[model samples]
Target: MLQLIEEIVYQVTGKNGLTYDTDFVQDLALNSFDVMNIIGKFEDHFDTTIPTRDVWHLHQVKDVIDYLAGRGFTQP
Candidate 1:
């Protein structure tokens, strides 16, 4: 899931070399619109709409996996 998020970040920022440590807003220069688009893709990919309150809590790749797991998306 982290890898998939990396891919989506790459696609969104048009940055081919994005890594897990890459900061979404700093390293990637992602704005609010880009964030929304990425979140949309994530919802579509996981078939779950993440709650808005949890959106601001995402700060890294692992956060996404944790959020999905918290939502019961536990596919290994």
Candidate 2:
């Protein structure tokens, strides 16, 4: 699951050195457009739809993992 998150973040940010603690907006400087793009990719990868409002709640990689877990996406 961690690797999955890493891959997704890397794909979106084009930064392969991301850590779970890395802040999407601060560390990666991911703007609103980037966030939207990331959410879209994550939806496709997880095969689930994430609400736009809820996307703001995700600040770090762990937040994404928890959100996906709530949607029953167990680590592979």
Candidate 3:
């Protein structure tokens, strides 16, 4: 799951290096547009809808994993 999330992040941000603690904004320098794009990709890949309110919680790679886990997604 982490690897998949990293791939999505890389696809969206075009950044190869990332850590679980990396912040999308602070570390990856992703603006709102980039975040939206990432979110769209995530939704498409996961086949889930992330609530707009919950989007802010996904600030790090681990956060996204946790969110997916909470949604009943297991590591593939």
lDDT of every predicted structure (CA atoms)? 0.74, 0.81, 0.83
Using lDDT as the measure, the top candidate is 3
The full ranking of all candidates by TM-score, starting with the best, is 3, 2, 1
- Check candidate 2 and list the clashing pairs: none
Query: What are the models' TM-scores?
Result: 0.77, 0.86, 0.89
Best by TM-score: 3
Which pairs of residues have clashing backbones in candidate 1? none
In candidate 3 the C-alpha lDDT for residue 32 amounts to 90
Candidate 3 versus truth, CA RMSD in Å, comes to: 1.2
- lDDT of the structure predicted as candidate 1: 0.74
Identify the runs in model 2 with alpha carbons over 4 angstroms from their true place: none
- How much does candidate 2 score in TM-score? 0.86
| Candidate 2 lDDT tens digits, 1-76 | 7787678767877876677787888888889988898788888987778899999999987787788888899764
Model 1 clash count equals: 0
Which digits, one per residue and each the tens of the lDDT, describe model 3 over residues 4-35?
87888788878867778888888888899988
- Whole-model lDDT, model 2: 0.81
